[model samples]
Target: MNTHLLMIEDDHRLAQMVAEYLGHNGLQVAHQADGTSGLAQLQSPDTGSLPDLVILDLMLPDMDGLEVCRRIRALPGPAAQVPVLMLTAKGDPMDRIIGLELGADDYLPKPFEPRELLARIRAILRRRGDGGTPAAGQSLRFGSLEIDRDARTVTVGGQVADLTSYQFDLLVTLAERAGRVLTRDQIMEAVRGRELEAFDRSIDVHMGRIRAAIEADPKSPKRILTVRGVGYVFAKQQE
Candidate 1:
């Protein structure tokens, strides 16, 4: 079945172009010109059966895209399961960081190539398992840390850890590939479904936060180790 997509862009020309292109690429596209209407479409009775992804533009007639993103992230159940890729003219690192921090899965600067846009869309959908099977029933245990894919929860040292969607995915990706030295670019591609920003430190900041939550001693972490001049690695536990 073709994956459904909801595209919220105020520009009629851009919306029509994107919708047509994505439709030709085998996606079922639903277009909305405003955030309010987009939210309505997302909340409609048929929403449960609607889009698997949302492409949201930052400039909206009624509300900011960040607010729309927060509302979507705050939604409960299957609605919240839908991943969003933010589109904006602003290329500021702070803007991108804020979008991610607000639960946007990824961001694309305007004046981007349509090919790049397609790549981003495919990457997001692929990571979200539209292109592959999801690990739905698996559980992983390393030392006192336990990851439950079924419940979408993580427990560390017998204590439940509150993690954002991105953080949980990042931890899972790292834990599943323990002992592998994943560079920042690799890690960003793995978890965020896009290329890393040249000067972004959001990944490092998130890693630190995850360590503080899961590691016995965040100052001297054992599970997630930093490799000098490289990136981060999940250290395999020694039995």
Candidate 2:
């Protein structure tokens, strides 16, 4: 099945270029000029099934991309959980940080090479297992926390935790090697199937977001601990 991707961008030219490029590479692209229409389409039941992924632009003609991301996360059902890849023209690290915190699966800065964009898209979709087969009955449990690899979900104390697709995988990577201290490079390398792609401190940001979802107290985390000068390690013993 060709992956369906929704591009919510105001730049018609760029959208066209991306659509053509991705279309050639097995993705069906749908264009939306603003966040309002994008959100409306996502919320509308008549739109049929949700897209596999959303390519959201940070600057929109109608609403801020951050607001759109917030609303997307608030939407009902699977629509709220669709992976988002944010696009920004600005060269600010804060934008990437905020976007990830707001539930974006990934981000690509503007003036980016199309090949790199394709690679990133492939990486995200691969991590999400776009159309790949799922491993049966594979789930990791530590105390009340359950990481369901098949369902691509995390549940804490019987309640579902809100984690982005990428974050979920990151957690699994750590959980699989619980009690081991992995440096930023090693962690990224472990997850780098078809190129995990990393920016400085990106993993840290994702870790913070993951902690907020799974940890009882994000400020003083227990599930995933920071080793100060080292990287991070998932606690083998959990409550």
Candidate 3:
């Protein structure tokens, strides 16, 4: 299958540049100069065709980028799962946060080099692939907590939890293989896109954070167990 991408930006020159650059990089690019048309195209199965990725501009003449993002996320099923990379002139941290909160996988400020944009886009897609959407008829439950892999979401007693990308991936990985021991290296490979360095403490930090969030008692974790001189395991009853 071809790698399909939709670029939505009102700036004709910018859109052309991006489309050309991405195309040169071997992706089938679809361009739209306005938000309304872009939204309509995305919704239109005949024309939109559900691209693998979306490059969106936050400022549109017809609508706010945030609104566009919300509408896209509201899309049912597979359409809603398409990764979005928000390319905009807005540089405020709040704006970036809002973009991610609205379902954007990544945000790149304008004036970015085409190469950098490509790299960012690649990383976002790689992360999504690492998570692997939940399989049909397969749901994991732990107490009141639940993980719907299909939706890439976790709920606690029916209430959705706000988790960072890393956290979500970690939880899903561990829960998917409950009761199995996973070394730090294995866990890092499963979620993080790259290899772990010998001195890297990133996994430890992530584990601590996850324990704090999911464990009823962080001091004595029940769900995530540590194996001395080995690795970690996910289990309600200690093995």
Candidate 4:
């Protein structure tokens, strides 16, 4: 199946250009000119199936892109877990930071090449999967915690753990290499990201979120421990 993408962009010309370009490249593109319409589309998929990914604009006609992102993450069911690739027109690094903290999987600054955008879209989708660490249907167990690659889910004691798709893959990267400390660069490389920015602390942000989801106490994470000046390591032994 061609990857499906919903783009919420206000610029008519840009939206048309993108839709046409992506459509020709083996993708299915759905366009919404404003945040309200885009959100409504997500809330009620005309095709009765959620798009695989959302391409959100930072600046929207009715709401801030971040607000739209916040709403998307707040959505219930699988829709809430859909990966988001945010588009920003600003040069401020904080915008990217806030988006990530709010559950955005990736961000691309405006004035970007269509090729780069397509590349990013592909990367985000690929990184959300097992990504070489675990095969489909493989499950990793640590006490009450379970990482199921086939389902792309993480659960602790049978209770579903809420995680963005990117976060799920990040967890898989660490779990598959339990007990070994990985630097930020190594983690990013392993996850096959479009790679995090130089010295970007976004990895820390993702780790904090992941800890909150699976750890009994996120404040004192036992499953994933920080290596003070090094990076992080997934614990091999868990209670």
Score every model by TM-score: 0.80, 0.94, 0.63, 0.93
Identify the runs in model 1 with alpha carbons over 4 angstroms from their true place.
134-137, 149-169, 189-197, 205-229, 235-239
lDDT of 1: 0.81
For candidate 4, report its TM-score: 0.93
Look at candidate 4 and tell me the lDDT of residue 82: 81
The clash count for each model shown is 0, 0, 1, 0
72-105 per-residue lDDT for model 2 (tens digits): 9999888998899999765688988888889998
Against the true structure, what is every candidate's RMSD? 3.5, 1.8, 6.8, 2.1
Candidate 2 weakest lDDT stretch, 10 residues? 191-200
lDDT of 3 at 128: 61
Q: Where does candidate 4 stray beyond 4 Å?
A: 45-47, 129-136, 193-195
Residue 15 Cα positional deviation in candidate 2, in Å, after optimal superposition = 0.5
Q: lDDT values of the candidates?
A: 0.81, 0.88, 0.75, 0.87
Q: Which of the predicted structures, 1 or 3, would earn the higher lDDT when compared with the native? A: 1
lDDT of 4: 0.87
lDDT of 3: 0.75
Residue 193 lDDT in candidate 3? 54
lDDT winner: 2
- Evaluation by TM-score, superior candidate among 1 and 3: 1
- By summed lDDT, the worst window of 10 consecutive residues in model 1 runs over 126-135
lDDT of 1 by residue, 103-201 (tens): 777678887787888888887776666667557688988988998876767898678875555677788889889999999999988876667877877
